[model samples]
Target chain A: MADKLLITSSPHIRAAKTVRSIMLDVVIALVPASVAAVVFFGVKAFGVLAASTISAVLAEYLYEKAVKRPVTVGDLSAVVTGLLLGLTLPPAVPLYVPVVGSAFAIVVAKQVFGGLGTNFVNPALAGRAFVLAAWPLHVTSAWLNPLTMDAATGATPLHAFKGGQAAGSLVDLLIGNRLGSLGETSAIAILLGGAYLLMRGVIDYRIPVAYLGTLGLGVFIFGKPGALFQGDPLRGILLGGAMLGAFFMATDYVTSPVTPKGRTYMGIGAGLITLLIRYWGDYPEGVTYAILLMNLATPLIDKFVVPRYYGYAHDVAARRKANRAGGELS
Target chain B: MQFISILLAGVLTSNFIFMQYLGLCAFVGLSEQFETAIGMSGAVIFVMTFASTVAAAFEQFILVPFGLEYLRTIAYILVIAAFVQLVEIFLKKTAPSLYKALGIYLPLITTNCAVLGAAMLNVKNQYGILWGTVNGLAGALGWSLAIVIFAGIRERWKFMNIPEVLKGFPLALISTGLMSLGFLGFSGLFKTILK
Candidate 1:
């Protein structure tokens, strides 16, 4: 009888979720945007997605094998990173762009700093940043027109919008009729995926809510060139990668803050930076950099915004004083 | 309005460490701990501000009048070294704990390119003493912001299982590169606004 009961360490009762399961859910959540990309941008978008996803997995497997570490490709985090990177890129980039970007994302951004959760910044965004820097012309201007899939040389809606011209109708923006990154064009699709993630409890609500809310508020306040409180907030949130980033990238479990309050601050900070970049900086889309900047700040936020131990809520000051005293002593 | 633009440019667009890649020796050396980074930041803010003021004064009263532009670099270094010495003495007397914390890096500020760079930039921009001081304060604030944030990130590296090859400076450089990538968002921020 005693032999029938397995002896184990603490945490004998395990949660049903695993890293693979969580990653699988994220993959599912991304499907709407992926489908939207293919529908809007044609077969090339599919190729970009496949190239990045496969290359990311392959890079992780090869790097792990080379370094004699346990292979973690089965966890599917690489797939998510690759897919996210592909989604953020211009739809018509050469295949090598996704390949190189994914390889860099997996090996340098994710694996080198210790794989997955240990990476300081979001791996996909880091890859996008690298590719953007390496091939600025291709990454920034390779936009495809919806349905026709013709190369678009005109300014994206974001650029026109920044120039105080009307971007498009609200419905067109929602259905992704504008020229932009592959998956970021379709606001509705991204929202669907974000809703799924929120409902499944896979991501915290504070980040997306705070992010979009602050962005909306900011756009309203200072969006128009010669007017205040007259800018179109609805158009602001729907345009560019704000929808996609607020939902997917900014909520990455690894690079985001763990505490709820810290996550909210992260969201607000990202929003403010995005506004700053979009309004005044060279970039038309600020979502990627804004999220990456906030990721850098996550550690600072976590360090300062620690949650109080349960039942010791009122002892916060005393605990802080004690900790400071202990620090001085050390 | 010009002051605001200069401040924004100094703090974000042309950050001393991330953008210009100046004063990296102290940036990497003193960023291991958060408390120490804060101490260094305060020291830099003091030394850089005073150094810029004095350098601008020298440039205005001595270099330009004497047509001694050739000696500008040496004169700026002298001004910086003098200011660093002043900071060392002041911190030692007023804040011994911070003085001990800053220790070698305090004196090393004499060699920090950001300080000299700020002074030189003031001369190049032909900023008056007041504007140069503001620029100095902005640059130092930007450097302090980078180190403090970096120290926060590095503090967590203690628990991470970083790969053997990429430990220490290699990893630090990689992290700094990625951070610089993030800071790229701030590039051209002043193009539209300040125009």
Candidate 2:
């Protein structure tokens, strides 16, 4: 009898999941936020998104063709990069900026680093940080208010926070009815996007919730209460890029730690760094820098946070050595 | 003389990579391997120099004149992205071997805030087109210098016995912190020179 034989050393049933499919899911998840950006920023948003996507794809495609590598640009990771890059920029950015950001996102950060998975950091954030550092006036200069381009342009929430006013009403912030980066204003919209991601299992909640909760706790604990208790920690949580960073940036698969314990620590670190920067550092918004800093910590976190085998002695050799040394000293 | 100052300021004192800690993703990420390190640096040098020149012109002649100065970030991003693509293509066709090594790392340059930051600084500092190009080159050189130094340190790092936790990036960060502390010495140079 020809019996059905089990043939597997490990992973008896390999999940039918590919990077290509995951990226597509992410694309689907981002659609709501993309639509919101377009609605808020107008046709300019669409143009920026298109330019960024096309340029990222084209850059990766041509880079692959030149190198004679199998083109992975079809995976739509370039599109993801383009979208993330677009969301990071101010909506009023010129038509060309997204396209350029797209190229940088794909070619230099992604392609040069041995393509998508091998990249050490989030390509989108890396690109954003690079341009923001290189062209401060450009990144900081052009911001579009929701649905209003001509009347009142450059009043990002952080700018207002720096100016010492009640930075924003909770409602305005929640609804994305305030001035900020292209896609970062609305706590509600970002939370919606985040929820979609969670539902899709594209990411886990540990990183985001931990990062956000810690930020809220740290801010409230460190900051003075207004008239009520703890100075409205929710405000600290809602304002800035807390939502964006928690949901999007901190969850970056490439740059974040692998082990659960490491992820927890990373979230804690992200929170502390973010609070430190937002409260005292020069920048009013600290999510980008905080996330980048934590990304730098992921490899180390993984190294130390390795899982232990069940029922095995914890550092048995070390314990033996210590006992021997103790006996010798006596 | 003013142009020289712009160049100097962009390169030494107000550098995008090391001093200001901008575009650190590439600096920290690519510093591990020398080949990609050099390639990334080359891309930065070319893009920075060219982008600065074009951005200066665009800001002065186009955006400022057209009253679309608000679009600087978007405009610069687009221009820089397109330019990087062009350079990638040219490098591929002219230098396939170099292209092969640098291929995967190119797309990440798009979101690099340092490139955009420099372009914006050019306008903020009221630099002319000529001055912008110089600043760009200087900034690029500064970036390359930082990466080269970092690469050297990281190369040595491969041999040294390091704690498991601090082996890869943690140690790298500690080293970067030390290097940054060292850069503090040069800050005085700018102060005296400018003064």
Candidate 3:
């Protein structure tokens, strides 16, 4: 009789999840926000979304093909990045902005770093930051009114809130009637999508909960113009990209911490930075930089905020007890 | 007030790495290890301060009087290279341990743009010998501060689950970009404070 024995290292058990499946789930969860974006911003929103998504996928394909790496466009990660990048736009950003932004996100931020999993910061945010820096006038002053799709300007709610003024009634802000980024204005829709992801177990509750919770607390504590403990926590939470970012971006597996406690800390730290920027920073919004900065800090967080190894606590206790007994005998 | 502005501008506002975008080769290459970064930073401080003073005096006394001010670049380079060589020899003789720690980076400082840049900037700004020395020292300190902090971040980055393509240089570049963003906060800081 002949017998064959195959040996492998650890990781004896494997899950069925693939990168494709998870990315698909993320894309599905973003549908509500995209739909809401189009509903609020009309065909222009759809144009930006389509342009970004297509350009991102094409950029990834070209990059992989040029570098002789296996094409990973099938993984759908680029699609998710494009979608997120689209949603973060100011709705009036020219068609070329998303195209260029998506290309940058894919080529420089995502592919040049060795593609998807290797990107340090979110590719979408990197692209956004790049464009924001390159064309501050476009990114900053490109806001449009919700229903009319015409140029409407003044201060965004975060700006008004900063100046101790109200941008709209709470209901208008909640139902996504405010002027803001393409997908970020609709707090209710974002919550709907966030709920789906949470229910599907696609994300950890620790990050979003801790993120929004800390942001609300920080805003309430230090948000007032000149006084402490006088800011509107609800308005602060419901106003900007806080909902979208807390649920989606901050929880990016590659960029966020792994362990449970570390994730919580990542969320809270991002929230604190967001509040700091909105209240005290020169820019009116901080979610993008806040999350990006926290992503940069994720490695540090993982290094220091580690979970205890199995049975290590017992080993330490035993060692301590042995040392005590030895001392008594001496 | 003027001295404070100069110091603040060099150390934060016009940082050699983030602001002037000089000496980035060393910044990216030697920033992988904390001890190595500290060692490199020490060499930079010594060479920059010493070279700035020497180059300034040469430009002010020798080049200016001779009507060869356009040769500032070549003169500064020669001065920095000679100074770095002297420091290397002195370090090897007096402090073998530090020489070992700094290794080849000591000689590499001859090409380190921060040193040459500091020397040239001192000339361009037309700073006096004292102000030029302060600026050079502060610029090196700023470079050291940036590298040490980046090294701390990169040291922790080793344990991270970085993607394959972005594992080394690409990740370092992105980290640098984000860091530059953070440093943008220092823009006009002194102006605001003074106002």
lDDT of 1 by residue, A1-330 (tens): 322232243232121135667788899999999999999999999999999999999999999999988677877899999999999999999999999999999988879888876788999999999999899999999999999999988898888877779999999999998898988999989989988898888888999999999999999998888999988899899988999999999998878887777889999999999998999788777898999999999878877776566556645664465334323221
lDDT of 1 by residue, B73-158 (tens): 88888777877787788888998897787766777788788999999888788888999999999999999989998998898788
Give the C-alpha miss distance for residue A211 in model 3, angstroms.
Answer: 4.1
* Positional deviation of residue A165's Cα in model 3 after best superposition, in angstroms: 2.1
Give the candidate number with the greatest lDDT. Answer: 1
By TM-score, how accurate is candidate 2?
A: 0.59
Q: Which is superior by DockQ, 1 or 3?
A: 1
Better-scoring candidate (DockQ), 1 or 2: 1
Give each prediction's DockQ, rounded to 2 decimals: 0.81, 0.03, 0.17
What is the overall TM-score of model 1 with all chains considered together?
A: 0.91
User: Model 1 Cα displacement at B108 (Å)?
Assistant: 2.5
Q: If the candidates were sorted by their lDDT against the true structure, best first, what order would they fall in?
A: 1, 3, 2
Instruction: Look at candidate 2 and tell me the lDDT of residue A79.
Output: 76
**For model 1, which pairs clash?**
none
RMSD to true structure for each model, in Å? 4.8, 17.2, 7.9
Per residue, candidate 2 scores C-alpha lDDT tens digits across A150-169 of 43454666655534457777
After TM-score superposition, the amount by which residue A210's alpha carbon in candidate 2 deviates from its true location, in angstroms, is: 1.4
